[model samples]
Target: MRELTTAETVREKGSWLFTVRDQYGELDEVILVPCDNESGSASGQASTDGGVEAWINRCTHEAQRFDTGRGVPMREGRIICPKHGSMFDSCSGYCDNGEAADTTLPSVDISVRNDGRIVLTDDELTFVGEGGIDDNESDGDDGPASTSHIGF
Candidate 1:
């Protein structure tokens, strides 16, 4: 199993993004969204086990990405689709409403370790790195690069 990130980091950020390659050699990404605790509260408890769930980052209806390299919009244990209004349960990934009604998001297997380290346990997917693939990565420069914010 390849370690993705710490559970604490996912808990803090509400989600963590990582790149992966499947058995067919297709590159994709996974989003680890934080799940609610037993009391229905999404916060206030810190542990090394079982507070995050991994989804394929695509909606079941239109294949629209839930995260889109940004944070997922969540509401009370449900992951909201940005394109439509479908909501999937954070724990089960079942969508009970909207265009994705009665469908479930395909989940990627993940394990939260005793040491607070989150690892990808799915044999079909290999961990590449953190964050989604940058679409702008190429060998050629389009033009003279301008000094932008964040020191590019």
Candidate 2:
């Protein structure tokens, strides 16, 4: 990973980092967060600015990546999975309610450089409220199995 500096943070207000397989290549996208906290018209609302928040997904439950040209974020404040129709809040990247059609999304850690640059790293990411379940993991009945996974 490349070390980020203070000056570089100012240059990239909304910066992103992702791997391109084999650790051979990486891509970054930068956008300016206007006072409204929105980069373009497509995003419905502008959120507050202070810390770094972002969406890391390719599509919604409907399978639509963001329109790079308009800079519209994917599924707005949440990253929804198209395959299972799961929605994960962008801020925490956890499912609001793990219903059949509402699975939680994975969250990547991120940080803000003192100079105002957003830094995304493993340390910055953690599951919201409760971490998402890992494929190799299973939940035991500690609370109330009757209430858990039951939809009203």
Candidate 3:
């Protein structure tokens, strides 16, 4: 597990942007939004009171970075994608409007330690960057083909 930031830090800002290297050795950014404190849940979920939730900083529709420039706008416990005015459920990362309708934001698993530190879980550590592999290209072997999938 990778230590992201202190829990207190996230509680103060309500949200934080974390940049980390994926298993592929490429840079990937995740946005951590704090859930309501009254709920006592550390996992990503929207709350009015303020736990931490993590999601890929990119929009699922057009692959646009949600954290670019001024960052995404938060209203009524949701993050609005500036590119297309899509509102994603902050905790679940579900989008129900705009071009991103029915699609959900990729979530990053995380845990808050007793020491008040936020850590990224192992299963959510791998991410493949855009065009990392070509779908039309092959290994050039006609025999039994091998397949492998990488994702966070």
- Model 2 agreement with the true structure over 47-146: per-residue lDDT tens digits: 3333345444344344343324334333555444444555555544456543424443333344455555544454433222111122113375456537
lDDT of 2: 0.37
How well does candidate 2 match the true structure in TM-score terms?
Answer: 0.36
Comparing 2 with 3 on lDDT, the higher-scoring candidate is: 3
Alpha carbon lDDT of each predicted model: 0.79, 0.37, 0.67
Report how far off residue 2 is in candidate 1 (Å). Answer: 0.8
Structure candidate 1, residue pairs in collision: none
Name the candidate that leads on TM-score: 1
lDDT tens readout by residue for model 3, 31-83 = 77755545333233334322667888888988877766344567777778878
Give the C-alpha lDDT of model 3.
0.67
Off by over 4 Å in 3: 37-50, 69-71, 123-152
* lDDT by residue (tens digit), candidate 1, 1-152: 99888878987887888888899988887889887655432222342256888899889999888777777888887899999989998767788999999897888888888888988999999887788855423348775576556653
- Scored against the true structure, residue 96 in model 2 reaches a CA lDDT of 58
Clashing pairs in model 2? 61-82, 109-124, 109-125, 110-124
